[model samples]
Target: MSLSFELTQSIAIIGGGPGGYEAALAAAQLGAEVTLVERAGVGGAAVISDVVPSKSLIATADAAVAIAEATDLGVQFFARGGDGRPLRPQVAINLAAVNKRLLALAHQQSEDMRAALVAAGVRIIDGHGRLEGDHAVVVSTGPGGTDFDRIEADTLVVSVGASPRELPAARPDGERILTWTQLYDMRALPEHLIVVGSGVTGAEFAGAYMNLGAKVTLVSSRERVLPGEDPDAATVLEGVFTRGGMTVLSRSRAEKVERSGDGVTVTLADGRTVEGSHCLLAVGSIPNTRGIGLEEAGVQMTDSGHIRVNRVARTSVPNIYAAGDCTTFVPLASVASMQGRTAVFHALGDEVMPLDRLRITANIFTAPEIATVGWQEKDVTDGVADGIVHKLPLAVNARAKMMGVRDGFVKLIARRGSGTVIGGVIVAPRASELIYPIAIAVDRRLTVDQVSRVFAVYPSLTSSVADAARAMHNVGRVAEA
Candidate 1:
C-alpha cells in the first residue's frame, strides 16, 4: 500500500515495543523523519522478557511432553547397567539451560528488531521518554539519566506497553514469591509452584510447568479455568490439567502471599493456605501510562490509566496517537503491531483499515492450546449475535487418532440466515496454528459452504475444521428454512 501524500511530516514514537517499532518502520518507509525513543532497547518487554521468553519456555515444555508421549506411539528407550538389567529414565527438564536459551533468543530478537529499525533510516534513542505537550517528546538519556534529548514532530505515537500487575497484599519479592517476569531467574524448577490467577498467563505457566515435570497448583477465583473462554474448551483444559496431576483450586481467592523458609505460603480468602516452593502472580497488567504526560497533552485515558484511542489508533488529541497495551484495545502483540501501522497509515494519508475487535484472533498457550476468533458461543447464547454453533470432536478425525491425540474438538459459529462464518474455537495441540483458517473465514466473512469447499489435506487435524464447517452448513440451511 502506497501513501497518498509526500513524506514531508516528522513522526516521533515512544516505547520501542511491537507497536512503536512498527509505527517507526512504516513512517520511515513512507518518507517521514521518524525518531523512536525506548528505555529497554528495541522490541521492548514483549521480546526481552514477556512473550518471547515465555513462549520459548513453553516450547521446551512441549518437547518434554512429546518425549513422555513417545512411548504411547511405540517409541521407547532403555539403558543397561553393569549387571545388564534394563533401566528406564524419566523425562526431565534442565530448567537453567532452558531459561538461558530462551533469554538468549529474546535478546537476539531484540537486537534483530533494533537492526531493522536502524537500517530503515529511523533515528533510535535509548532513553526514558515522555510527551512534552502534543508536538514534541522529551527523553532522558545518558548515564544516570542526566542528559535530555527532544524531538519535534508533526505527529506522535505512544506504545509504552505495560508491566505485570502486583497486588498490595501479594507483593512479589523476586525470589520465592515472584512475578512472571522474574520466573526465568530460577536455576532449577520449583518443587511445587502455586500460580495465582486462572487467566491466560496463569493457566499457560501452570500447564507449562506441569508438563515440564513440576508439581503445579492453579488458584482460580472463578468456578472454572479460563473464566470467559469457550465453556467446552475450558472443560477440556480443566480435564487435561486434572489428568496431568495439576491441582486446580476453583473458587479460591488468594488474599496474601508470604515468603516462608525455603518456600512460600499463599493465604486464600477462606482461611485456607497453600504452600509451595515458589509462587507466581499472573493477576493482570497495568498500562505504563503513568507520569507520561498523556493527560497534560490532552489525551483521554481510562480509569486504569490506559490511553483511550479510536479505531484508527488516534488519541483525543488529533496529532497524538497510542497503541499496544498502553491503549484501550486488545493487548496482544499482533494487535499492537496492526494498531501501529494503522496509526501511521491514517496519520500519513495512506489507505487504512480500522481495527475491529470482533475479527481479532487470540490463542492460549497451554497443553492442548485453545484458540478463538470473532464471535463466540457465549455471544450467541447471550443474544448478542444471531448465530448457529456446531461442534466436531477431534477424536473422530483420522489424523488425531493416528497422532495419539485423544482430546479436543473443533467448534464453528455462523450467522443464522447467511451461514457466513462468524466465529470459531479450536482445542488441540498447536491450536495456535490450526486457528488461522478459521480466522481467515471470519475476516473474509466466508460462508460455511465456502469454507467446507476448501479442500483440507486428508488425515490431517485441519480436516476437522472443514468437517465442522460442513456440519454447520446444514444447521445454517435449517435455520434459514
Candidate 2:
C-alpha cells in the first residue's frame, strides 16, 4: 500500500546497498522524495563484490560437481588415447573465465538496480555520504571528491554495510594472502588454499575450491566447521570435506599468515604450520559505521560500532533509522531489504510489521546447502523453546535415491502441545529453496498437521519437507497421548 502524507517528505539515505536501495525505492513509491548516496555502485557490496559474485562462483563450482556426480547416474564420457585406449573424461574449471562471468553478472545486477532506482524517481548521488545531522546528509561528490552537496530531509536512513574482518597479524596483500573480496583477481585456482576459519564463509570457499579441483585445507578454531550452525548439518559437511580429500584441521587457530617463497605459510597458535599457494581469511565482518557522524547525531551505537535499532529499524533518534550490517539486526541481504521497507513505512506513518529475527531464513551455500529458519534443535535442547523435534534423512526419500544424494536430512521443530511449526532445518541440494515453505509455516504459525495437509509435488525433494511435517504430526499425537 502506498503511504500518503499531507506534505511531500524527503528521505536521505547513506550507502546504496540492499537496505539503502530498497528504502529508496519504497520511499519513492510512497510519494516521498528520496535521495540515495553511494560511494560504490548502486547494489553496494552485496551485488558488486559479495553475494552476487560469490554465489555465481559457487554456481559454476556446482556445475562442475554435477558433471562428476553424473557418472554415478549412468552418464558416461570417453576419449580415445594415442594408444587407442578409451580414457574417462575429467571435469576441469577455467578460473579466469568463471571469474569473468561472475564479475560481469555482479556488474549487470548493479546496473539493473541503478536503472530501477532511477525509474522509481530516486535521485542517486555517487560519492561518500555522511550524516550532517538527523535531518540532513552531506555528500562528497566529483572526480577528486573535492565537491560537496548537502541534502535536507525529514528522515535519514543509514545502510552502510560491513567489511571482512581483518586481523593484525594476517593482513591481506590482495595476492597470496587475500580477503573474500579479493578472490576474483586470481587468474587460476591456487594449487592449495588454506582457509583460516571454519565458519560459513570459510567452509563455503573451502568446499567450493575443493570441488573446483583445488587442494584445500580448512583451518578451524572450533571442533567442527560451521560451529554456530546446526551440529548435524555441520557433521555432514565436515564428513563430505574429509571424504572429498580436503584436509580439515579442527581446533586449530591461525596465529599469523606470512608470505613464503612462491607460497604462504600459516602459523598456528599451537606452533603448527601449513603451507599453501594462497590463503583466505574469513574470520568475520565489522560494520562500516565509523566516521559517519552517527555519534554526533546522538544515535545509539553498540560497543562493536553497530547502530542500535528497534524492531522497526528505528534508531534512538525518532527520525533516524539504520538497516543492514550497520544495524544490530540479522546481516542478510533479504533481511536488509525488509528492514529498509519497514523503516520507510514506520516513518511514513503507515502500518508496519516489525521484523522478528527468529523468522529470518539463513542459508550456507556449500555443496549441499544448509538452510534454517526460526528456532533450531539446539533451541529446544537448551530449553529456550518448548518444542519437539523430528528428523528424516534424505536417504529415505525416493527423489534422493534417484539423484544419488546420500547425505542430508530435514529436521522440524514445533510447539509441544499445539503442534505449531516454530522452526526447521534442511540440509540438502539447494536447501535454500526447500526451506522457504517451512519459513512460511513458521511465519504463519502453521501446525504440523496443517503443513502435512499441504500437497507437495511428488518425486521432488520438497516431498521430504511434507514427509517430515507429516511424521511430526504423529509424534505430536503420541506425545499428547
Candidate 3:
C-alpha cells in the first residue's frame, strides 16, 4: 500500500499504555489532534494487572522480610497460644487483604493516567481500535460487538502490548494454577508453591513467596535464575534465593501441571514430579497483535505476530507505527514509553532520535532488584569492545552494612582508552533507583572520571555507584580488590 498521507497532524493511538499515552501527550504538545483508544483501561496491563499489582504484592512481602530481619536489631516479639505456650512468633499474612490493596493501587494508577491524558486535551475512546486500511481504523465501542466507529488519521501509533504466555499443558485456572495476572486474587498463601520457568517473573514471585513464609520451589530451564542478565548479578541473586530457603531447580524443565483433589503436581520432561499446593507459570508473553488487522492493513509482522518496527517506531506501512512489547523484543515499560514518544516525533516531522537501546535502562523487581543499562556485558566478555570492569561488593558499603544487606554488588564498565561509561549492573535493594546515574552517564557519553567527579550523598547506597565509576576510571582498580 503506497499510502501517502499529507501530514494533517491528526494522530490516532491504539492502546493506552506508557507507550500509547506518552505518544498521545507528545503529539498533542506538538499541536496535533490526538485520539487514544483503549478497551480495558488507561495505563494498560502494565499498571492494571502485571507491573503495579506484582510490585505491590512484592512490597507487602518485603515488609514481612524486613520484620523478620528485625530480631537482630534488638526487636523482640512475644505471642502465646491458648495453653500459655509460646506460639512460633507468628507473623501472619492476609493474602486477600494484600491482593485487595494491590488491585486498588493498580486501578487508582490507571484512573490517574486516564485523567492525566484527558487533561492534556487528548480525546479518549473507551474501545478496541484496529486498522481498517492505510489511513483508517475501526473502533468497536459496543458491549456485545454490535456497534463501530471509524476514525481516519494521518498517523497511527500501535502500542497494544502483550499478554502473559500460558502453556497448553499447564493452563492457568486462576485458582490452583495461576498466571502473573491472576495471582493477585489468591486468598491464601500456598503451603508449597512451584514456580515454573525461572525468568524475571518466576524468580521474583519465588523470592516474594519465600519472604512471605511460603515454601517455594523455583523451576528453571536455565542454569541460573536470570540467565540474560549479568552473570555475576544472576549468581548473587541465585545465592540469595538459595539462602532464603527457596529451592532452585537449576536446568530443570516442567512438562505439565495437574491439579488433584488437594494439591497441584508439576511433572518435569524427565518424568520427575514435584507436588505443591499451588503453581505459577511465568514462561513469558505473547504480543497482543492478532485480530488487530495489522497485516490486512499492509503492516508487516513477524511469524509470532509481533509488529515489525524500526527504532523510530515506524511499521512497514508508511503512516503507521508500533511500540512496546507488541513491536519490540524488550518488555520494559520505560523503553515502551520512549518508543512511543519517538513515533510521535517522527510522524509529526519534528526532531526525533531513533531509540538507542544500548543506552536504555531496565530493571527486574526481585528482592535484591537487578538493574542494568547501556552496552551489554557480553560486549566486553566477547572481546568485541575495549573496556574495563570495576566491581564493589555491597557487603563493604556503609549503608548496605547498616541495613544488613550482604549479597549484592555494583559493577561498572567503561571504554578502555576514553574511559567513557558504557555499561553497568547493580544488584541490590532499590537497584532500580541506583541505575539512573549510570544510565545518564551512558546516555550522555560521560567518561568514568566525569561520573566519579560528581558528588554523591555521603554514606548513601548511591555513593557505591560513584565508587565503582571511580574504580573504572582507574582501570579495574576495584576489580583487583
Candidate 4:
C-alpha cells in the first residue's frame, strides 16, 4: 500500500460512536478534510448510553464486591458478633445517585471526545445524516425539521452503530420493564431483578446488580452464560455468579415479559413464569441500518441486515466504508475503533493494515471480568487449528492468594510444534488489563518461550499470564505422560 490521495480530499463520516469519531481524527491527521455527522452526540451510544455508563455502574458494583471481602484483610466491619453465624458483609447503593453520576460521566466523556475531534480540525455536524445519492450526504436536524446541509465527499464512512432490540410483547415502559439504556434512569435498584439473555450484556448487568445488593435471576437461553466466550472461561464465570447468589436458569428461554401489578412477570418458553420487581431485556442488538438510505446509495447488505463489508471495512459501493455494529461481526467498541482507523487509512490511499478477524481481543465487564484473544478450543478440536492449551489457576499467584481470590485462571494456547502463542483467555479481577500482554503475544505471533521470558512483576496477578505461558513452553513434555 502506498499513499496517493490529494491532501484536500474530503472524507465524510456518518455517526459519532467510537468508530465515527475515531475515523474523523484519523482522517484529519492525514490532512483530509473530515466532516462528522451525528444525531445524539459526538461519542454516540458508546459514551452516552451503552459502554461508558454501563462500565461506570460496573465500577461501583466492583467496589462493593471488594469491600465485602475487606473482613478477610483484617478490616473490622462489625463488633465481635453475638450470633453464632459469621458476619457476611452487606452494601446499600443509592441508585438515584449512582445513575446521576453515571450520566454525568457519560456527558463528560462525550464533551471530551467532541473537543478532541474539533481540535483535530474535523467539522462536527449536529443532525441526522443520510446518503443523498452517489457522492453527497444530506444532513437534517431530524424528521420534520428545517435546518439542514449537504456534504459532498470523495469518501464516506458509515459507523452508525446499533440499538437495543425490543420484543413487542415485552415493551419497555422505562420503569418496571427496561432495556440496557433505561437502566441508568432507574431511581432504585430492582428488589428482585430478572435479567433476560445471557450474552455479555446480560451477564454483566446481572452480576453488577447482584453485587449491588439486588436479588438477581439470570434467564439464559443457552446452556451457560456468555455462550460466545471461551467455554472454560464461561464455566468459571457461571460458578462465580452462582456463588454470589445469582439464580442461573440455564436452557430456560424467556418468551415474553409483561407488567403484573407492582412487578413484572417473565414467561418462559416452557410456560414457567418468574415474577420480579423488574426485568431487563438484553436479547442482543439490532444494527441501526434501516431508513439511513444505505440501500438507496447502492450499499449492499447481508440477509441478516448487516452492511456487507470486507476485512478492510469497504462496503459494496465504491468510496464507502462501514464499521462498528453496523457491519456483520462481533459488536465491540475496541473492534469498532480499529475498523474506524482502518477505514480512514484505506480511504485516504495511505499504507493500511487490513482488519484481521482472527486477531481480535474481547472483554466482558462481569465480576472477575472475562477477556479472550485468538483461537479457541473448538477451532483446535475440530482440526481447524493446531495448538496446545495450558491453564493455570489464579489461586496459585501470590497476589491472588493475598487478595483471597480463590476463583479464576489464565489459559494460554500455542501452535503445536512451533510453540507460537496463538490465543489466550483470562478470568480474574481486572482480567481486561491482564489479557493485553497475551493479546500482544497472539497478534505479534510471539512464541511461548518469548512470552514466558517477558518480565512479570513478582507477587502480582499478572504473573499468572507468564506462568501459563511457561507451562505452555513445557506442554509437550507434560502431554507425553
Q: Each model's RMSD to truth, in Å?
A: 1.0, 1.0, 3.5, 2.7
State each candidate's clash count. 0, 0, 0, 0
Give candidate 3 regions above 4 Å deviation.
1-8, 79-88, 476-481
TM-score, every prediction: 0.99, 0.98, 0.95, 0.95
lDDT of each: 0.94, 0.94, 0.88, 0.89
lDDT of 2 by residue, 355-413 (tens): 99899999999989999999999999999999999999999999999999999999999
- For model 3 the TM-score comes to 0.95
Mind giving the per-residue lDDT tens digits that candidate 1 earns over 296-397?
999999999999999999999999989899999999999999999999999998989999999999999998999999999999999999999999999999
Provide the global lDDT of candidate 1 against the true structure: 0.94
Give lDDT: candidate 4, residue 463.
Answer: 90
lDDT (0-100) at residue 288 of candidate 3?
A: 94
- Residue 3's lDDT within candidate 1 is 56
Q: Which ten residues in a row have the lowest lDDT in candidate 1?
A: 1-10
What TM-score does prediction 4 earn? 0.95
Which pairs of residues collide in model 4? none
Q: Which has the higher TM-score value, candidate number 1 or candidate number 3?
A: 1
